[model samples]
Target chain A: MFEIKDLKASIEEKDILNGLSLTIKPGEIHAIMGPNGSGKSTLAKVISGHPDFEDPEGDIKLDGKDILDLEPDERANEGVFLAFQYPVDIPGVNNSEFLRMAYNAKQKYQNQPEIDPFDFESLIKEKLTVLNMKEAFLSRPVNHGFSGGEKKRNEILQMLMLDPRVVILDETDSGLDIDSLKQVSDAINHFKSENKMILIITHYQRLLNHIVPDTVHIMADGKITKSGDKSLALTLEDQGYDAFKDNQS
Target chain B: MLSKTTNPKTMELETLQKQARDAFNTLGFPTKRHENWLYWTPDNEQKALERKFYEPSDSIKENDVILIKNGSLRSKPNNNNLTVSNDTHDYQNENLSFNLDSSSLSYLNTSECSEVITIRCRGIINEPLQIRLESDHTKDNSTVNTKVNLIVEEHSSITATFYHQQLGGAFNLTNTSFELVCKDNANVNISHVFKDNKSKAFFHSIIHMHEKSNCNHISYVTNSLLTRHDTNVTFYKEEASLNLKGINLLTGEEQFYNHLTINHKSKNCFCKQHFKTILDDKSISEFSGLVYVAKGSHEVDSQQMNQILLFSDSARALSRPQLKIDADDVQCAHGSTIGQLNPEEIHYIKSRGLTESEAKALLTYGFAEEIIEEIQDSHLKEALAQDIKETVRKIKS
Candidate 1:
């Protein structure tokens, strides 16, 4: 289970996440819908231990263990994954080599013996096929010149390869065309299991149609204002966030 | 003997030599006051310049190697398409076309040089040629200075690698220079490498491009105490282009200095000079590249970029990329970047589970690959790729 309690974070003396909290049990998909600057992205960054929020006042635990003191990479190895809203371009870094390094890192972190690089290639090819990404994508520099849709698919490719217990897709649907959206959603559904936890952070209800969530939460002013079943998302999408904002106020 | 002395060609050579002697005597050595030698002019180098070096006596003619030691040609190939000579000729086919006072060292080389070795190419060479410039010292001889001239005749093509190595005592100086000429419709590619450790060295290359000629020059300079490279290029005719690139890898307390002057003097010419330097430990890299376009040289294109990567906090980088455009229809741009490994790049790699140092090493290796992949010759490209890999590995550990 993934849980956040009283998460209070600030950036450059400005409050961003004020007493925000959520709990995600195993075998559940939760979608966070919110207006811009409602701390949705900040919440994801705080969970993953971004350096900007160095000493956030909160309790972030995974499987009943407090992980607030962990580094970003440590959090990643601890099954916390954040698909960035805007993926950074790392020029000159080969895609396959980067994935292999990431995979071996998690392996070494878990005290498991490192797999041979040759074996890792075959493993990555399987994941690439599932994501429908070409083999040439593995040779080019990581996200250096990739199109918008391609970068989103690359995020899914990483999720498939690492198989983290907690997957946080932050705006992974924006800027993606319909075909890419369905493809990515299908892969996410395929990866879903009873032992995994998924958090989908998006503004539109379109993505939720493909990867249906069990619960929907409306975030405002850095904290959850309302929580309900799937139909609540349809209500908010139909009436816009203004209706939800009036109700919250 | 009297006829040899009275020949007009000999007279012309003797007059030029006399002028070079006078020029060297007047210019002497550059000091801190010289704008071009500011950061590199230490008083101790003057002592090294005064050291005496004797001439080499042995010679060997090989198939594809031009081997030289202490200003003397030791080996050259015996081929019909290639001719190696040191002869004085008429103005129409003269080998020396650069200014004598391009640098003070060039003047000294001209005055003290016993003979000028010219390697001329008349047709396409199937295999790439190798120029081996080496330095050695014993009880009798301890210092050396050498230079060579390369000429690609009209409608000819050639590829060559110039490798300079120093294997002398810790306290020695090696000075060398070369002048290359690409005649009308000629094509040339050159790869230069310098590996001199714990010693001081200076190398200069003066290049001239004629009508429709093209030149690609790449340099790999590293592993030296104090290394200085001075390159001067002049586009003398229309439709000529010069693509110059280099990589300087410095570690420990090593220092490398680069200075270039690119002059686009004719219409429809192109000039590009890009250099990347990697510095680690307490090393330093200094670069100054200037691209000049004359007033009437319209439709000329020129670009200059200097990128420096520092692996340590104490490493220092100084860069100056200057452009002086006098043509209205020309396109010219210059940029300089001095940075450590990208922080975002580092974070992205680290988030994938790599430790900080491993991430840094991988980025460093990749930075080198982007430049090495541009070389056209496969053999040279592979060799440089391996060399840079080993160098980066050493830097990482």
Candidate 2:
């Protein structure tokens, strides 16, 4: 459902992703593991249309349609979701109000009926039950005073609400505790179906234990160094990216 | 005679114009030499637009109460509690009278307006009165002056919205003065919205808050063309509190100057002033606030914060906060910030599903929402929000 060919991305004239390529089919889960500055998060941001992640040469497609020219919101409308590493803290904007606007924007783009306030409230409540988020969180400003775990969970909650066909999780497990990590994994597992594709981007294998990926790709120096089955993630957990760094030279 | 020859309409306005012109000629325009005008005075560079006079509109539609045309006063719709009992307020108390003797605005409004609308409320009104003053007619230079005095009885609470809506292509000068006599333990919310046209417009507003009364004034002035507004609010009496917030978001050659003074006469009084201005192109925004703590006025708390966001290199802002404390044991502090959008906030919002323009709009909206949300009336809040959004859209578009 997702494909990238020779993706090259940069920031402020500094190249981060050079000739990166990956593909994940429906019903499959993939994990991209790399060390610091290895372009793991850059890959995710590039796919999500981050303005800072400029693509000089590449083609990224979802379901056979080029998405390089689409805006971030337009990509989300096309069932592409990116779970940011750190959610923004927007004061004076109610969390529910932001969600409603985003939800309606996507719905309108997809030609679906917009949800009213009442129905939207109930819908958020139902999703909150799945993510174990408190009702008070809905009324507070977006991520204004949220803890690390809460921000991560809020990201997952958005993924669930939008129900994107191709989900890209960027460092989604970095700040989560064991319990919160399991909850987030459970939420992802609940949405796991035959028609959805998930890409988990992380440096550790802890998240892999909960939501096992069908394939593991080791990224180093802005390009994929190796790809294998789930055993590669386990081997990297025991060994680390040191093995891949040596192979690069 | 000069003003009349330039724009001849009615004998009433011509007579009033002659009277105002004679007053101005005798006592030239108030300058820095005058104590009251020391802190505020237009430079010689600002050419004076000719002031013309027109008939007042007293039509009483609920929506039209706030919508005055020409120089006439319109009653707030369904303001039964505000019985228009015609009685002039004795402006003199001790040696100080709010009524300025040689002021052209005071002379024109007091002499010409034989019938003054006395707006009073004993209980909370279901709908806050909306006063929309519209100026769409222009034969030559036009002038619209109004004096509205609001009195809230003891233990009464009400919210009133005063709107100055000007749309035309003539030089216009409008003056509005309000006296809010809030009896003990009364609360009043006053919101002023100024929507001026492409014509050269000048507006001056003065409000007085009385003893033990709580008053909140939210002023929003957006100049689509060339315009200037001067506002002053004074809080008198012990334990009386006031909040003064003003926002000027403008483009083109619009210029706005706002000066607020809080006179803490009695003990234990507090006041807060927060003003934000968004300027683009060659527009200018000026803010001046002074907190005066009189002798024996102990424990007076006051704070003033002015934040200006300049989106263009040519846009300018000047903010000055002055504090005078006669009492020793008082807390008074002031601060001003003038800068562009925070790069961190912009990046944060952009990381989400928003583009650069979309993220800037959201961040700027959040900054302005601080003052807009403090409005007590829901309808006014919505209207102000929509207006602000429209401004943002214009800036972005």
Candidate 3:
């Protein structure tokens, strides 16, 4: 249900994402593997409508509607969720309070009845079965002093709460221990359905072991150099990106 | 109109002015020239030169009195266990002194006064005492100086909220001298809110603590106009504790100045100071705090912090936190932070589906809550929260 064609995005005046293009339909999970500083996060930020990153030339459409002009919040309202690799530590704002406000804002934008605290608490508790996080995490400030794994799990919890149509995980597996990686993967897989699209951005293939993607895309410099089945990831893992350096997109 | 009454009226104004002018001239505006007032400076261009004493307007019915103005409690009419001694200039009360600057004055009033307002509860109060002091006139020059003495008896606890409401656009001076004696095992919390208008006003306050007394003082001063405020606190008894917090919320083309001093004179006394400031639209704020640890005051633990949020190019904050530790064995540290809003916090809040303005509003509210939560008064907290929201919105707009 999402499509990106020849995407070109820049931060300030520097070009980062050059002529990049990719697509994911309903029920599809795609892995975007790229090395450090390879414009992996920029793609996610551009799609999420981060104000500092602007798409100068490209088209991103959700269900056939262009979303380049939408503000970051508007993009989030349109069901685009980007799980940041390094979660921010928001001090003084209670976790539950933040969740409620966010959930209500999305609900109000979609013309749905807002969930009260009671319902929201129950909803989060029900979903916590996957992440197995403690109740105290909901009371403390969001992500402040949280373990790396806990931060990743918290992102998954937010994704489950928002239940976005297109979820972009920007290296969510990084910094997470093996156990946290499994929990995060399981949570994402649990939320995966025929009506949802998932784009996984990572530097390694370890997460693919738990949540297998339908397709894999290799990114170099600023463009998606290759796209194939899950075996493509295996091939890249074996030969490294050097094999595709000469035959770039 | 220059009748005998009118002439004496002028003479009274002149007499009051001379006393204050002399005191200030002698004190000589604690300046950067002086180490104590180094952080803040009043706008010399806009001075409250003329003083007009309005006849006490009994217009505010007794029922309208909220028992506390800003963070100071009312003690005259009903309660008995809470003894409020008068330390005003007219009374021959024991004088309390501090190393820093102080100005005291007295005025005549016919309003009813209470000797004791008892607060015997042992639990924390969710409704903080709110003292809203409105000027008697909208445009008349004025001076209001009074000493409010709060005494918490042994095995008791209470929280007082004070809101200094400057409703009129007139030049005014308000001096609130508070003395709180918390007996053994008693707890006292006080919150002070200084509301600013288009007038020039100067607020000076000094609070003293007794033996084994625990007192928390919080003040929020939002300046949209020119104002000068000073708060001095001293703890004299062993095992006593104090928490002093000040926040300066400012905007517009005004100069706001604040000088605070806390003195710890006894052994094992503890104190903490935190000041947060938000400035925009060419507004300037100067905040200076000094914590003095007397000799033999062993095991004294204290920390001070000043954080400023600059929202515009011309906004400024001059923060100086100084400490004088005569005791070799003491824990005293201070820090200052001057920066804009955390961009990541703003992005995180915005990504949660709130617009930029909405996200900023939440961040500013959260920043103020760090000190507001210590107030222990729900009504006062809510009122202060409302004021914070309004201030943030005003800055955003």
State interface RMSD in Å for all models.
Answer: 1.7, 2.8, 1.4
lDDT digits (tens) for residues A132-244 of candidate 1? 88899999888889999999999899999999999999999998999999999999999999988999999999999999999899999899888888998999989888888
DockQ agreement of candidate 1 with the native complex:
0.57
What TM-scores do the predictions have? Answer: 0.90, 0.81, 0.85
**Candidate 1 global CA lDDT score:** 0.82
In candidate 2 the C-alpha lDDT for residue B119 amounts to 66
Number of clashes in model 3?
A: 15
For candidate 1, report its TM-score. 0.90
Q: Give the TM-score of candidate 3.
A: 0.85
lDDT of 2 by residue, A1-249 (tens): 789889998888888898988899999999999888989988887787766765557888999999988877677778888888988787778888878877877788778898988999999999999988889988888788899998899888888877889999999998999999999999999989999999999988889999999999999989998999989998988887787676641
Evaluation by TM-score, superior candidate among 1 and 2: 1
Cα lDDT tens digits, model 2, B1-397, are: 1232332222333354455556555665557786545544534312322344556454555543554565455544555555433334322221222234334444544444444445677776666767665655454455555555666777778788877766555444554445566767788888887775654455555555567889888888786564455555555677888888877788877777766666777778778989988988888877777778888889888898999988889988888888888997898999999999876566555434455686677777877988988898898899888888878867843
* Alpha carbon deviation, residue A175, candidate 2 (Å): 3.8
Docking quality category of candidate 2 according to DockQ thresholds: acceptable
User: Tens digit of lDDT per residue, candidate 3, span A1-249?
Assistant: 799999998777888998898889999999999777889998988887776774457899999988877888888888889898888887667788888888998999999999977888899888877788888888888887898888888989999988999999999998898888888888999999999999999988899999899999999888998888999888889999888887754
